[model samples]
Each structure stands twice: as C-alpha cells, then as structure tokens.
Target chain A: MIRKGMIILVLVTLMAPCVFAQRVHIDIQAQSFKKFKIAMPAYTGQSDLAASLWSSCAKALRVSGVFDVLDPRGYITTAALAEIAPGTLKDWSLIGADYVVTGAASSSAGNVSMTFQVIDLSTSRKILNAQYTTQQGSAYRAVHAFVDALLESSLGIEPLFKTKIVAIREEEGRKQLYVCWPDGTGGQTIRGGGNLVLNPAWSPDGKKIAFVSYWRNNPDLYLLDVASNKVRLISGLQGINSAPSFDQTGNHIACTLSIDGRPELYLIDLATSGRVRLTDSWATDTSPSLCPGGNDLVFCSSRAGSPQIYHMEFSSKKVRRLTFEGGYNTEPACSPKGGLIAFTHLASDRQFHIALIRTDGSSMRVLPGSGRGDESPTFSPDGRLVAFASFDGDLYVSDLMGVAPVKITEGGGFQEPSWSNVMK
Target chain B: MKIGYRGFVVVLVVSVMFLVTGCAKKAVAPPEVEVTPPVVETPKVTTEMDMAEMVDPEVEARRILDQEMAEFENRDISFEFDKFNLTPEARKILAEKASFLNANPGVNILIEGHCDERGTREYNLALGDRRANSAKDYLVFLGIRPDRISTISYGKERPLDPASNEEAWAKNRRANFVILNK
Candidate 1:
C-alpha cells in the first residue's frame, strides 16, 4: 500500500507541470501599438459563400489596425476542421502565429450557419467558439459579429466593428448624408437632392441623425429616423439654426441658434420642444459637444477674440475657456470616456490640424499625420481612433497613437464624419 | 429864311428814312414774340398730358431697391483674418448702408454673414453671426430700425472665391446684403 501511494503522488506531480505549461496568458495591454500576429484559415462550407465570409472577416480584422494578418500562403494548416480542433497549435506556432481563427459555414435554403473559434496558438486553448445563423445575404454581418467577438476575447477590449460612421458626401455639386461601416463599405446615402446638407450628428441610440439642410432655402436643422427614412424638422429658427449635437441620454440636444440675434448655444428638450438658453455672449458660441455624462459640454466660442474651445457646466452654469494655445481652435468633440477633447487647430502654418487636449486643460498634443484642412475630428466609441475629414474631402481614420492614418473613403467632399456608438 | 427852308427839307427826308426803318423793326419784333409763346408752352403742355406716366412711388422704390441690391451684392464689407469686429473701413461702409436704409425705409434687408475657409464650419458660422450682428448693431446705432434688418450666417459654406489663397480668403470673409422686401 505504501509503494502504490508513492507512485500515484509522483504521477500527479509530473502532470502538474504539464497543466501549467498549457495555460497561455496574452497581455494585450502590454503589446500597446504593436500588431498581434494572427493566422486565419479558410472557412469550410458552401465553397463560394465560405470564400466570401473568409474575405470579409479577414478584411475587417486587417482594417482594425490591431492585428497583423498573415497571408493564407504562409498558413501550413489548410484544413479548417483540423486547424480548429485540439492539438493543432504546434502547426500555427511553427509559422509564428500568436492567434489562429478557424470557422465552418453551411448554407441551406437561403439561410447560412457559421461556427467559428479563436485559438491561442501558444497553449492550444480555444479562446472563443460560437455559432451564428443568418440569411445568406447577411453573411457579412455574421462575419463582423465573429470578428468583434474574437477582438474582445484576444485583446480584452470592446470591439468597434459593429459601429457605423455618418458623414456628408458631396457629388455633382450636391451634398448628401451617408452612413457606412467602419471599413468604408456599405455606404448608403440617407438623404440627398437638396441644395446643401452638412454636419451630421448621430443620436446616442444610433437610431436617428440630425443634420443641417438648405431644403427650405434656410439652413435649418432636420432629424432623420435612420430605420424608416422619415425626416422631421427639429429647429427652423428665424436665423441660423445649425450644428445639432445630442447628449448622452438622447433626450436633449444642444445646438447653435441665432434667434436671439447672435449665434449662441441653446439646449432643446426633445420631449417638450422647449429651449433653454445656455449662452448669452455677444460673441459667437457654437458647436456644443456634450460629454459622456451629459452634465457638461465643450464648445467653440469666439468670446476671447478668436474661436477657442470652452467648457460649460450645467448645474453651476459656469463657463470656462478650455483651449488657449492656438489662436484658432474649434469644432470640439468630447470623447466617449469624457477624458479628452479633440478639436481642429489652425497652426502657425495657416493649415488646420487635428489635436487633442485633456478635459481639465492639463495636456495638449497635436495628432501626427494630419493633412492640411483636416477638420471635424470625432473619436471612435472606444476612443482608440479618430476619424476626420481632409481638405480634399476624403475621410481618414487615425489612431490615438497618431500613426497609421488610413483614408477610409474615396471621391471628394466627405466631411463631418461622426462615429456612432456600438449597436446592439 | 432861305437856309431854314433848305434845312427843313433835309430834316423831312431824314425823318422819312427813320419812319421806314422803324416800321421794318416793328414787323420783326411781332414775329419774335409769336415764336417765344409756343417755345415756353411746349414743356408745360407735355407735363400736363403725361401726368399718369409720371413715376409711381412704389415702382420708384422698387427700382431703387433693385439698384441697391445689385450695388450692395457687389459691395460686400470685408474684414481682417479671424476678425468680426468692424474696421474703420468696414464701419464707413456700414454707415453708408445705414443711410441707404434710412432713405429707403420701406425696404427690408437680410445681412448674410460669411467667413473664409480658414476655420471650422461651426466656428465660421458663429463668426459670421458676429459679423452680421456687428453690421446690424452699427446700422441700428446709425438710426436704422432693427426690424428692417435680418441676419444669417453662412459660415464658410458659400465662398465668393473657392480658391485657397490669401486673396480669395480676404474676399470670402465678408458681410453681404440681400434685399428681402421693399
């Protein structure tokens, strides 16, 4: 009996080291601006449908700027079923892949079902495994869902793939509003056939968009229900009624109304259609951006001789100037976390550049790689990226790190790009 | 007595020549007086005949308003870079505009505030509002009624010149006047 007990204890001691060896901890925060290497094998199913899903998933991941997607030719594991099963980490690790994604898709009677898994190549552990069913035409959505899940699992960060970007696109001397995916795909014009439409602001719920249109021969504010394509007039004040921004609750809006004989900030209650004047300055005050909590707002005011960003507290009714470095800074957009304010700064070179400043006015940094005439900088929902419009009218996305500025839109006259919150 | 009779005959011949010349002068004077009456009455007759064709005040006001609109459209008040405060030159132009408004009290004007493409759209719009209001306030101070003037800020949307240079920007940062009613 004593000899048998000694043998069993020795066996358990030997297995404990192997269990510890199989656990992989990928500290994504430590990677910072470095892209993680990932290998994605082709999904198995209806050949054409699987190929389409594979391409979309790969594109979404690549455009996210967090992954260095390896070419399929470098992937030695060609079988999707084999790659996703257990004990296949050695093959992917051999090719220097930190993470591996494999999926199988099937289509029947116009419905498509896909099963996908994200594996940690170092420890041979499956980090994510899920199945999604959708109409065959909506395969792209399913792939986006999977990519978002993989992102969350691998990086421990919220996914931005499900969010949309609203911007104004001009064509043939006409300006229109459009909504597109983050990757600049699936662009559809929501409204057009007007003299000019600009400054699209998305509601916090992502169901409505408020924009300025000259349809009535006046620059009036209009709200569009994105689902029904219905338009409603929000404010048609006697004078300039423009630059509408929704608060966090989505129940109140802050905009610039000239009804008081000067461009001033006014908060409009969506339920009662009542307005409360927030600013009464003789100088111009416009472009009110509400912080995440909706209790505070940052806007551009010309009270200090030139356009500069200012902060206003709701309860205290106190107004303070936030930006003073540049003689010209305007169109301030507060981040989702309410810690940073992004604005357009007119530099000494007489060119506009996108810049960031702390909400408390402690630090200021001009984001690198900003093009001339870059204005209307809006932060992504996660605050990881900032999308802005350039002078040539193309929309470009830049990381908060100020690197890898990718032009996401083509053609000209795309301005006022506003990122939407992640949709449920 | 013989010398006196010879002198009298000379006087009689001289008097006869004087009478003939006097009658000829009298004949020319009547014709001149006849011609002067028609020349003086011609303008009076036409003035009376065309009483209905005389300028109607409404039509005259409209004509003046049209002329003012055309003139002011070309006479936009310009400002320095990133400035909404009126310069001496801008104020002078506004004073002239105020006088025009005072003269044409029946006309209502819309002051369009504009800006160069040097700033953000929303800020430019606000700056434009300041510019238009600045002009309006000066007009009010100069005795133009506030109700007679309205203001709108076009920001950097409608530029006079789309070129991206100093000259074009200077032209773009201006306040334009448009006639809404007269």
Candidate 2:
C-alpha cells in the first residue's frame, strides 16, 4: 500500500502544471476567442414560414459570431418532422457538423410558437430544449429573441445582433448623419449637410436626436424629429455651444457652453429655455452624458492636470472623479444599465482606444487591447452592443456581451457613434 | 597714479563747469540764440539717420497682410475640420508671414483661428483658439516676439465660406491674420 501511494503522488505532482495553466485560461473567458459551431436544422412549419425562420436564425447567429451553422438541407436525404427529432449521427457527421439543432414554427390564435432542440453530433444526444412564442407580426423578432436565449444558455453572453449604430459620414465634404445595422448593412442617411453637423446623439426614447451644427454660423443645438424628418433649433444661446445629450426622461439636454468664457456643462429645458450651470471649473468641460439614472452627468475636464472623466450629481451639484488609471479619458458614454461606462482612454502608445470602467470607476479594461485606436462607444438599448468610431476613422460595432466585433463602415471619416434605443 | 587722480579731479571740475554752462544756456536760449545767429558759425557735418527710414512701415504692413491673405487663399495654411494642428503648407505660409513680421518692427498681429461650420459652437471656439495659438507659436519660433502676437479660436461659428461643400469647408478651415495693434 505504501509503494502504491508513492507512485500515485508522483503521478499527481507531474500533472499539476497542466492543471494550473488550464485554470488560468478558463476564467478570463477567451477575451477575443470564437465560440462553438452550431448546426440549426430548417425549422419545420408551413414551407415558406420554415424557410423564413431558418434564414432569420442563420442571420442572427452569423452576425453574432458565436455559431458556425451547418446547412440542414445538406444532410438527411429523407427528412420529415420525425427525422428532426432523432437524426442519425452518421448523416450529420458526413455533413461536417459537431452539433445539430432542429426547430419548428407554427401559427395559431394570432401567436407564433417555436420549439427547438440542440444535439451534440458526437454523442448523438440532446443538449438543449426550449420553446418561444410571440404575436403574429413579431415572428421575425421572436426568432432573434430566441437566439439571444440560446446563446446565453450555451455561451453565457447574450448576443446583440438586432442593434442599430448611428454615424456621421462626410461625403464630398458634406456632413450627413446616418443609422445602420451593427453589421454595416442597411444604412440610411437621415440628415444631409445643409449645414455643418457634429456630435450626433440619441434620446432615451430613440425617437429623437440631438446634435450640434453651424447652420446659423454659431454653435446651436438641433433636435431631429426622426418620424417627421424635420429639425428644430432647440438651443441657440450665445457664445460657443455644442455636445448635447438627452437625459433619461427626454425632457432636457445636457450640453457644453462657453457663455461665461469657459466651456462648461449646462442643463437646458427643451420647453422653457431655462438653463442650469453644472460645472464652474476653469478647465474646459465638454462631452457630457447623463449617468444611467438621468440625475447626473459624466464629462471631460482638463482641471485635474489632464483631461479626465468627472461625475456630478444634478440635485446636490456635487462632483467626483471617475477615472484614474489612464493618462486621459474623455468622450464618456454611460452604459444603459449603468453597469459599465465606455470612454476613450489614451494609452501609452499615444493611441486612443475605447475602454470600459465599472460605473463606480473600477476594473478598467481596454477593448482589443495593445493596438487599434477606437473611441466613442455607445451601448445598444439592450446594453449588449457597443458601437464605436474606429480610430482608422471609420465606424465599427462590437458586442459587449461576447459577440465578435465587426467593422460596419469603411472610409469617409466616420466617428462618434450613438446606438439607438430598441424599437418596441 | 598722479595722472589718474588729477584726471578724475579735472573731469569733476569740467562736469561742474558744464552743468553751469548748461543752466546759463537754457536761460539764454530762444531769443538769445536768434540774436547770436550772425556771430555763430554752423558746421556742415554728416548726421546719422535712423534705420526705420529704410522702409515705410505702413506700406510694408499692408503688403504683408495682402501676402498672408493670398497665401491662405492659395491653400497655403488650411486645417482639417475641427483641427488646430498646423499642416506643412500652412506652416510654410506662416513661416513667410513670420519672416515679414520679423523684418518690420512695430507691427503686431492677432492670429484669428476660424473653423468650418461643422461642430459645436463652443467646441469650435476652443478649437479656433488652439488653431490661432498654434499659428502664434510658429511665428514666435521664427523670431516674432510673443508680445507682438496673440490668438483666438472662432470654433465653427465663423466661416469664410457659407455654402456647405468641400470648397467652402476648405476655405473656412483656416487661420487668418488680423493686425490688432501696430
């Protein structure tokens, strides 16, 4: 018994390094790693509806960058609804699949119901079984909603495929504002350059936009009525004025003004034209965004030696410092849930990259670290998608919830992206 | 040593005599000087003229201003949208202006930084300030006195071109020279 114990101890000691290395890698969760491949079979319903459902799921998964989906039609020569229930592993493997899934969609009583199952092709065993239902007109949206659930259950991060990214593009030296899918697909310019436009921002309702323009040859705030395609000069106070962001209630805008001869944040009532001064420091204060609660704002100030993000409460007019780890952190955008705030952090390399800090100002991390200059990260309504202006001066979208980032626009100098609130 | 001390005493006596002479002369000046014109002989000797006579300052200043405006119009000193950094062309033009200013004394300038009508008014004002200051720094580096130059930014609030196009934007993104005090 003594001899056997000694041999077992030696074996265990030899394997300790491998175990340590595995654990070290496991917890960080592959910062930029790809997820597993998933094969989703054609959802069975009416022929046209099944094809629609399959296409929708495929689009979501492909954009999510989480799943390498296999074509369901590529295998199972004789497929029926029953075959989707118990498919042979040999046929799935022949089609080069590691995992297989089957789903069926049906409509009854004005609601669409979908049931799906995920199976491991190697073991030929079911891993996940779930059901989703939604009203008739929202069937397409229901598929995306379902995919978010599957991704969370399997990979632990919900996907943000349905989010929209807003960017300003200058074409022929004309500044135009546009909104597009996160993947850079389906973009439409909502406003054209009859005037110089900068710093486009979305309201909490996602129905209105606020931006700065020199249409009147002075800095003025303009609110864009998205539905009517009309713009109104919301704020035209004297002196230098720009950088406008809406509060959570959509009733007021926080902006920067130099009326007192130094740039500072001012809260303006869109209805009353009544203004409240937020900061009185000598340093320039610009790039203001409401804290997730709408009661406070985070802005850039050069007062603390260099430009840094500062927080101030609206009611008490108290101030606090937010970032200390970076040389300069500016252009702050508070996340929807207020879990994290994104801002442009200047790295030692002299390149600016978008970084995240916990709303309480801890756990600072730069995205795609060590290279790539990125800035202006705006979160989606779901708080999962981060659309930022690429340092190469283009627009790119990334998922804060584990979806791989993809550059959405090319060339023409796009910057300062603000993601729209989810359409209900 | 005797000569040094005696020379000092002599210098003092002469200075005292000169002071008395100066006081007497002041009292007798004007009417007395006119009365003595017949007895006094004026010497015909060459006198030094000041260096300022070599250049007419007003004309030179106007010339320099015209040159600056021409250079700016020729795309010599232009900036990207909302940028204050001096481009190489802008630097070259500014260098020429600085040389002209250095050549002419008593010519002070205000570097006015302007931006295209794009960007927030306040941000443009700051940017304009930076642009003007950047030009001032370059001029000072080239031997213009810092006291003779000052700067201000007109962030996107003022534009040389009112129309919204590349040509207009290019024209408006500029640093202009304004003679504030000469």
lDDT string for model 2 (A71-94, tens) is 555666535341344635666777
Residue pairs that clash (backbone atoms under 3 angstroms), model 1:
none
lDDT of 1 by residue, B1-182 (tens): 99999999999999999999988887785443434454454534443556766888999987977887687656889988878889999999888888777877888888988999877887777778778888889999999899888887788989999998999999999999988863
Which pairs clash inside model 2? A240-B122, A241-B122, B124-B155, B125-B155, B128-B153, B129-B153
lDDT of 2 by residue, B7-103 (tens): 9999999999999999998887575343444577697676977687788889898888777655533533689864567888888888778776776
Q: For model 2, state the Cα shift of residue A209 in Å.
A: 0.9
TM-score of chain B of 1: 0.65
For candidate 1, give the docking quality class from DockQ: acceptable
Best by TM-score: 1
Model 1 preserves the real interface contacts to a fraction of 0.77
DockQ score, prediction 1: 0.46
